[model samples]
Target: MAEQVQVFGFWESPFSRRVELALKLKGVEYQYFEEDLPHNKSDLLLKYNPIHKKVPVLLHHGKPIAESLVILEYIDDVWKENYPILPHHPHQRALARFWAKFIDDKVVVAVVKAAGSRGEDREKAIKEAREALETLEKEIEKSNKLFGGDDIGFVDIVGTVIAGWIPAIEECFGFQLLTTDNFPNLIKWSDQVVNHSIVNQILPPKTEIVAFMKANWKF
Candidate 1:
């Protein structure tokens, strides 16, 4: 019998979107539940991910997997032959994991701080974030397509914020965090990632995301 799959997620969360995209790319049929976060997190979410009490919890055959990156690996492992979200080679896989971690640990903080902080703090954050983006642009410049070379892989899923969320944040703030002139390769990659059918289908509309950010993201 096929295992039942369900994901508790939030509509505007890039982390939750990562798991959604991973499962969709793998052609896995699963149920999705949008959690009300930071206010009314569901009991199921608490039960599944007591440590984080976060969304994007993947429930497979009654087993719970928390953390977007961990859930991504789980999806890839369980449906290994279906789509292969991570590379098979050990070295390449390690690099993918490294970049994914970088995005989570470094890039995200810089970007969010740049977009959400006040005057001087925002300026400093933008500088830091630009440096990070420039480094990523150089990495992408070496590849003909995605960071994974020919296809979307681990890094791509973790970088979901750039494809949709960043743009919405920029719109809400009336400032450009990413642009062709500043980082061409990353912009191109973002377009490709967002335009990919699997990703595009699941992306929350830009207007919705902008409204959400305007209401919640303080400047």
Candidate 2:
């Protein structure tokens, strides 16, 4: 029997997009279900992910996997015949996982805080965000092409927020964080990732993202 693959996701969420991008990279044919989010979450999502009750849940052969990062690793492991998302060497794979965690715990958190806060808080958040991004910039500078080397991989997948969502968030909230002068390496990587044939197809339109942020985000 053919494998049954399904993804529960939200349209504007970078986390959700991460799962989609990984599956696409592996050339996996999966059904995508968009959740209503912040209002009417599907019962299936809650049933699958009782802890977080969030989108981007991966269901493979009726077994549900929650969390984007976990789903990414799972996808790569299951579909080893296709593109490898994580590095082959154990140490390199460890490094990729480390960087992916850093992107989430540090970079994503700082960027969200910077975009959402106000006054002194906003200034502090922006400072932290820049520092986080600067650290990432230095890391990316070490890569020949992308964090994953020649192709998109785990760290790059985890960094979809940097490539796709941050710009929209910045524009929607009228703030300037990531810039060419500040992060040339990151800017170059972002351009490559966002415009990459596969990734470009999955990313949501900037206009739609901005509109959604205006309507849903607290700001």
Candidate 3:
């Protein structure tokens, strides 16, 4: 029997987009289900991911995989023959995993805090976000185009927020987290990643994302 693959995601979620990018990078065909999010969530999503009840869930052959990072690794593992997402070497793979975790735990958190807060708290968040971005900027400076070297890989997929979502958030909220002056390398990488043929197809339009952010205003 052929494999049954499906993705449950939110349209504006970078986390959800991560799974789709990985799948497309591997040339995998799967069904995509968009969740209502924030207000109305699907029962299947809750059933599939009872713990967190969040999106970017991967349903493979009737089994469910929750969490975006875990789903990414799972996709790479199942489609090993296709374009590799994570590196083949154990050390390189470990580094990719480390960077992906850092993007989520530090960069995403700090950027969101910076965009959503105000006054002194916002100042502190902006500092933290800048620090995290600077570290990533230095890391990307070593690469030719993307964190994955020539092609988009694990780290690149995880860093979609930096390329697509962050700019929209920055524009809509009138906050500046990533700038060309402060992070030239990252800015270039962002342009490259967002313009990549496959990635560009999956990313939501910046205007739509801005409108969504304005409507939600939940940061």
Candidate 4:
């Protein structure tokens, strides 16, 4: 029997998009419910993810899996042979986890700080974010096409989903992180990831995202 899958998510959320992409890539059929978030979170979302009260909750055969990363792991495990999201090797899996955690702990926080604060605080945050981006650039400098070292994998799913906001982050803070010459590897990787069919199908217009971001900021 095919396991029934349902995902509660919001459109503009990168984490939510991550789950959608993973499902599509694996050819898994799922019911998608878009949530309003913060203002009006659904009871199901609360029931599934009581701690965070977040979206991107995947219900597989009525079993709830909260957190996008955790759901990705679950998807990969359930459909490993068909379209493997994670690398089979433990070391490779660790690298993907490291990058994902860096994005969560460091990049997102820096983005929030850079957008809301001013003077030395914002500048310091940008510098810290640059350091994290530089590490990514270095890793991809002389590597294969994807973050997984080849075709799209766990790292590619995580990296691309989050990096969609790089342009918005730069414009929001009046800073330019990606340039023609500087951060070439990251720029190349970003282009490839953004242009992928999986991402292109799911993302909204860039202008809409920009407008949405500008309005959503605390400043």
Strongest candidate by TM-score:
2
lDDT string for model 3 (108-180, tens) is 9997888789899999998998999999998988875789989998999999988998889889877888888
TM-score of each: 0.95, 0.97, 0.96, 0.93
Clashes per prediction? Answer: 0, 0, 0, 0
Q: Report lDDT (CA) for all predictions.
A: 0.86, 0.91, 0.91, 0.80
lDDT of 1 by residue, 53-151 (tens): 888899999999999989999999999898888989999899899989888877788988877787898889878877887888888898859986778
Tens digits of per-residue lDDT for model 2 on 1-219? 235999999999999999999988888898988999879998999999999999889999999999998999999999998999999999999999999999999988988898889999988988998899999999999874899999998999999898898899899877888899999999999999999999999999989999998989876
| Selected candidate, larger lDDT, 2 vs 4 | 2
Off by over 4 Å in 3: 1-3
As a TM-score, model 3 comes out at: 0.96
Candidate 2 least-lDDT 10 residues: 1-10
- Candidate 4 regions exceeding 4 Å error are 1-3
Candidate 2 has an lDDT of 0.91
Candidate 1 error regions (>4 Å): 1-3
Better of 2 and 4 by TM-score: 2
Sliding window of 10 residues with minimal summed lDDT for model 1: 168-177
